[model samples]
Target: MHKFHLSIAALAGASVIALAAPVQAQDTAAQAPDAANSDIIVTAQRKQEKVTEVPISITVANQAQLERQQVNTMNDLNRIAPSLEIQQAPGQNTGGGGSIRGIGTQTFSAGAVASVGVVVDQVSQGNANISDLFDVSRIEVLKGPQGTLFGLTTSAGVINITTNAPDFHAFSARVRGELSDAGTAGSKFGNQVLQGVVNLPLASNAAIRVSGVANMRQGVNRNLTTGDLNDNDRYGVRARLLWEPADKLTVNLIGDYARARAENGGDFFTFIKTSTGVGSEIANCGLVAREGNQNYCTSQSYVGHTENYGGSLQIDYQAEPFTLTSITALRRSTETGYSAASNVFRADPLALQVANGPVNRHLSLFTQEFRISSPSDQFFEYTAGAFYSRQKQTRDPETLSVMLTLFPGMTIPLVDPATTGAGANDKIVDESLAFFGQGTFHLSPGLRLIAGGRYTTDRLSLDRYNYATAVASNTVLNVGNFSWKLGAQYDLARNAMVYATASRGFKGGQIATPSAPAVPFVVLPEIPTAYEAGLKTTLFGGWVADLSLFYQKIKDFQAQQCTVDSNSVISCVQRNIDGVKSRGAEINFFGKVFDGLSLNTGFIYAKATYPTGFVGTDGTVIGGTQLAYAPKYKFTLSGEYEVPVTSRFNGFLAVDTVWKSRIRYEANSRSETTFRPHWLVGGRIGVRTEDDRYSLSVFGRNLFNVHEPSLIQSDFPFGGAANIGAIYGPQSFRQVGLSFDAKF
Candidate 1:
């Protein structure tokens, strides 16, 4: 039987889809003819440029569009952006599993850098809490390798986020309140959210804007063992100040602090039964019943906490023939979690503990960048900059493993400890310095040539400590590399352009965490070469379509190799895989059909394949064809339709749909490791006054209540006989909520 979750949101969405008739323009979109073609300003190339004019594949999601999509955090963008995919990889932080165009960081080590650059306000968010997307001006998704302009972390791409600037001449205030399924039986987070912003005009040249959010929502997964909801509470606030003393100089100061506390380290719904069967998945394990967020655990939950704070100062001075800019930032974050808890299962009558222990990580990073650029619109435009950053890992993770009781010779012979947990005390310091420059030469009135290069050097040191043995060790690593790119663009017409580019990107090596008397593992740098061609055109008056074809090859791919002993104890080390290749094409379109309707669409067809060469624990070479957790195709659509119903009231509806191909969950391309493809539909409809001061709406997502597990893998030593895997897909259920917004 196939049916959607029968909720209020579905009833509203059905009416909207019927009336809007194929569209994604947000409700707040201006009722103007150029709604779809409204030029979105972006900083993809380290400079402000129209999305259609830039020589890169980009996706822009503004505030109005974001609200219509019901975007709450970074992962929410997956529904609207084709290039961004948030996979829930095991043993990684929240943002670590994010991938762009099938390439992303999938490691449990702090030494490894992300393939996508998570940048906020021109500052890198190494370990910062960037979940809060409210008050943001726009989020730009730049596809393909961008190492030359962004940091080495951007071998795949970048998520550039810009916040709203303070208004210098106006005092403003706004508030948003959301109440969704608040305490609805076993399906409630008491999900009440209150967000407010205020801007004050200080002096004649300085203005400050501040915003804060208090979300009383948490995990909705109810644990049968403990009768408690696995909850993760998040709260944060940020402030920004803008000062313009003169016409030639501008200064912006920004600061933010955020913290989150999660129950059982956010493992509440992660280890539910894999199948939707009527009985237990494992024989004698009566704890197993149904699937989805419902879970049955033998052990109780634990607490996981995280705190993040950061600030940045940006100064821009325009002088002579060139503009000078500098940005400096400092950030720190700390996270704690108990990894091996609450997932233990014991088919036997006795419920002894299998493993228990706490692991913690701390980070402090500082970065500075200075650049000089020729004025825009020049025949010979150029920009040069130097970047420096230092990151310190003060407290590395610690682990303690307990022995597992093995029940051998029985019909089912898998270890099921009903038991007890690691303490590795390692610290690391990494410093990097780089010099980069790019030039765009207008060869003719309609032709341009582009070239850029960056030279980077890194020095790292580590301190390893073994408390049980009272011994300490030190290790050091140093490396240098260069990234460069060359490209050309031809103006086919006033609003259309064609471009081609070839580039080599570099990501620094990794020095694994300390593991005692043994030497620390060091994985060398990852080098990637990319070739791309693209077309950006505007036709049918205001329809803008952008297309790109790209092929990227990565060498010395970094990977985490782990092994589980007979005791079911897992240990991991960083390793370098042979290579991987990803080739794909993307299309993004936005246009206005009429004053009341607008359309936006995004699509991607990428094949990220891993070659056949991974060294197994047994020293045998094992490889897979497709990249784990990466889908070959993805399509998304969004739009808005607004029609005035009365002299003082307006009716509007917005809708979005996302469809993704099936994906493999692990390194091996076995049938059991694959999952079926799925599609999602979401939308919101509401009415507002013509003054645009107040508005209300009904919103919902995953309306079908589709049970799609973001990850599926064999719990090898636990699931006797068939090793019938475990399931975990956070926020997979249907959600319907009411939201209200007001402005003054």
Candidate 2:
């Protein structure tokens, strides 16, 4: 395997280098200029500049890269970015976790927060509600801490994706089709999709661009008894309008909706009692049983429909070297489906059973921001902004319970209402206001300094009332904090620069758990400080390389702890008790190595540890443990070559690989073994027309058929000790499919 990987790497490198070689033939006099020499522009610092000239560590995947690499969603981006990871929930209530540099939340709760922030066209996507894949122009990932420009939510940096804009000079249309085969564990899962887009010029200065997509995929699992269905069909669509009435103002109205009615049928675990038979090993909050079936796991399924609609109005006006902009946006989402596990009935064969049910949630938000920036002069460049937002989220009724039959001599124990209660609902309201300013100053011809700070005020109110259980509570809290950043850069040569920076970042304090009537309660807020140094260089006018090392310390880290009280109502305690220290290094390189070829690679080494304490399910304190879902080492490399076939036809081939060390789930606080280490390799072969007007391509992903589970666990007893009943979807297997894309 080592030799195989080395050979592939060598071939890819050679191909890329060949792409950059000067053309030797005058045969086709009609050939276009080499694409590699075009200047790449980016907006990493809230301003447009050459990508290679940006001081911060950044990665950009433009439209050409996306089309060549076949990147469609967050998951595709994950496979290529060594510093990032994305995973769906394993089963019900499993937290959806994404990690960057070994730091992130590992909870499936709607209220949980993610470590890295995702921003779409300047708007922060606070949650996964808007995570659907879409047609985009570019994706930019700024590594390390992003306090000065992105704010507190960016303690672990930021991912910004920008979509294509309407063109007034061109009237065009395109269509695409895809057929895919995926899954592992000897299962057959198929996926199909169709997409189309049109750009129309309504008038000289106004245009409209609209796109729609429909996709369907089948799951690998099947119900034992029903034989009916478990994992099956899912689909969605998006319509957008971009209107520019004048040169200074633009309005974009977007409406997109997605629905999945397929069986949520994923893998899950059942509990087995310890030798003492005092407690079960399962971690779910509650359990229930239906008919007589000894230890048979209950069937799990998912059925839900979600709708997302929003509008962004942006106004930009420039006067001399100063520019002012205003942005207004709104988003709303509602999801209703089951949020329970089926392990209860599977573990207790004699226990009465209950079918799965719904866990409904609705969220609404409105945000506005105004900013002014002055173009860089001989002396200074400055940017200042003010932002405000209002959000509301509601969770309706999450309940489960069971009735057990006892032996003749055994007595039935009384159950707590908190555990089997009905009409349990949660409501949260969040409002924030902030003002920030940053400036860059050139002290000498080759030296630059930057300083910035932000002051923010946040307020939150939460209410949880279980009407049927007669339990209710409400709380409100307000917090104010100031974060700052400072950096200095010195150029060592025309194509190389060295820099050092220090920044303070934070995550907003969360609402206290309403039902936890503890001795002393407070909102858990996270304050992290980061220090970093790095080198940026451009080689051969084609390759861009960046290397950075960083250390971050977080105080009062917020995490959820499940505590079983005598009343049986599991208390979700939120506390600001623990502290975490993290350190890591990252290296990124992208360039053309040869004629008609491109290469991109990244490496990351990160480690995170809890310095204070973490609470266990049994109410025991565990100290000095590693955080879950974070790998210690990760790397990725990809390269592609384009081959000319005819004046109207072109062909291309590409290979990409990712490798990472093992990661622990549940923060390794529990004694369970949940995951293993793995590596993945994929390749693509396709052809496109010279003008890029019409194309047909065949591609294969996960060519090695590796079972690199994104999430794993060892608590399901049905599969036995060594097996521990793992609940994971096979990442993807060797798939060969042909795609057709046309433009008119």
Candidate 3:
């Protein structure tokens, strides 16, 4: 399947390039009607310009494109971006992890941080907890390493989201709703959302704008044994206000609050059967059932709630030669969960030992940045900035489990043991500060030079206290790095530029877990450097294309593990691998073939391999092998067309498809049953008023009903010489829905 997908992608690329040949020649003939042309302006480079002008690898999904494609979240955007992937946690559905450029953390450990960074309205949402989206303008995805401009968290590039700001124009409002079904047995869901934006002209010199969103979704799936809802229920609300008192300076203050209640059945791999004499699947083994008198599977559940709030203030001043901007943002989140214990499978006969637990996490983040930029029209332009961020996180998790025994002809009552249960508490504080600058110098009429550098310092302090084992630990680490970038761009024509760059990225150091009940490990972080060359071009006058080839080397990559002491208390640990290398090439193109017709396509080919041998849990060497979840190929294709239906109405149609090559999800030396390949195709059809004030859209996603496992793990719980294989998340299948939007 992996080979087949790659072949298809290669063929498609060849076909599209062939089709572009004549289109490029006809560009001059179709150059008229500039206003009605389907050209887009983007701010991906921090300045508004034609998409074809930037000499970087980027993909833009504008507001109209998002709405037409029914994209409401980052997960939805993943379908059209080949190098990106998202996955939910083990026991809870509310939180998840994301990866880009084949670098991400897949563990459920509380201390783990994401490799990818998310930005909203220029404020950093770097943590894994800030994944929600609401009231957004557009999303800009920059592929490859983005260290120079995006800082430490963006080792795998950046996802910059610009939210819809307060409209200075009169009152505007919008409302939308959707209903969906999982297609699996006992699954159904629905969502309702209301949003509005209003602008008030206070006197002649001031204006105020307010925007708010309210959303709720019903849960689906009920636990067969507990007769309780298994997966469902989500809702949140956000509001922001903007105040502008002067023409040259503007102050924007924003605050939002969100809360949700949901249940989780962690990674529902097929259920286990109880005894051979069992009457039914539910009556087999309490929560663990025997499949064929030998194999068994355990069931787990979780109920969680999360609340978040944040506010930011921005001040901008515009001058003749330079502009100064200052932004300050602060945010906090609280999360709590109650879950049933996991890993209850046994080959021998035993009654289920029930374990119920709760975990809580509190997080706070603060950031301040000041920037000064030169005017855009000069022969030499520059941007210099100072950035700072501080984060604090506290976590407490408790679990209680009891052992149970039963006889064939006797009834066993479930009882809690007198053994003292164990609990763990952790507090983490991290701070980062950087001084960065970027400059563009015109060397000649057609050649330009660009260079950027950032000096960054990261400090972390961690304290852990275990109540069950009566052990406590504290660690502190500080690291510094100077990352720089140099690039040269040569314009081949009026709207084409070819550039090459050398850049570097770093991930911070962290405390590690001990193996074999010995000394604790404190591993240093990883540093990845990339050498890339790319071409940015405009063809057919309406088409924008970008292609890049990159090679990256990472030293000391961080990974996860766990260790137990003599007292049977477990401690989650982090470790560092010696070295790894990744090399890849990406191609992306978007164009308007004719009036009201547009198409977009992208492809990525990557390979990640370790040079030296690394030891696995069983002390086997894994060398010259591929890393986990790093596929060889991934591609995306989407097209949309708009047609006039009448004098007052228009019709729209679109098709989107994604294909992913097979990936190994486990350590290369340990297991082999970890690859999965899948493809998804979807479409949308809608009708809208000519003025774009009102519209109706009906869409179906994952229409092909491809069920592809997003994650796989082997040797998960190496207890007593048994290996467990766990898989999570396949595409949810076809979902059909209708939406309505209007401006009032």
Relative to the true structure, how large is the alpha-carbon lDDT of every model?
A: 0.69, 0.60, 0.60
Q: Which candidate has the highest lDDT of all?
A: 1
| Model 2 misplaced stretches (Cα beyond 4 Å) | 1-37, 90-97, 108-110, 181-187, 226-236, 239-244, 247-255, 265-302, 340-356, 403-419, 512-521, 561-574, 612-625, 669-672, 713-726, 730-736
The list of candidate 3 runs beyond 4 A from truth reads 1-39, 90-96, 181-222, 226-231, 264-302, 339-356, 400-421, 513-520, 561-573, 615-622, 669-673, 715-730
Q: Best candidate per TM-score, number?
A: 1
Please give the TM-score that candidate 1 achieves against the real structure.
0.87
Candidate 3, 274-384: lDDT as tens digits: 223332433444443322111233345456676777878887788656888888988888878753233322212334344435768788889898888888778898788
Q: How accurate is candidate 1 locally (lDDT)?
A: 0.69
List model 2 lDDT by residue over 338-380, tens digit each: 5424222333333333333466778777878888989776579
In lDDT terms, how accurate is model 2?
0.60
Q: Candidate 2 versus the native: TM-score?
A: 0.83
- Deviation in angstroms for 653 in model 1? 1.9
Model 3, residue pairs in steric clash:
219-232, 219-233, 273-289, 273-290
- Model 1 RMSD in Å is 6.6
lDDT of 1 by residue, 1-744 (tens): 001122334334434433443322122223222234456567888888767788888887766677667666776778768878876533554344578788877776766677777889899876454765677777788887786777537777888888787876656666675666534422333355566677777988998989887655544555455555566567889999999999999999999998877665453323343333213333233455344534444455577777889999999999878899999999988877754242433223222224445657788889999999898788989889999988887664354444433334323213322211234567888889999988899999889999999999988787876554566778777989888989999999988999999988877778776333345778888888889999998766656788999998889877665444455544466777757888989998865546777677889999888776754443545454567667899999989898898999888898888888988666653455466788887777888778776788877666676656655544333332134344453346666777777665
State how far residue 643 of model 1 sits from its true place (Å). 1.8
Using all chains and alpha carbons, the TM-scores for the candidates as numbered come to 0.87, 0.83, 0.83
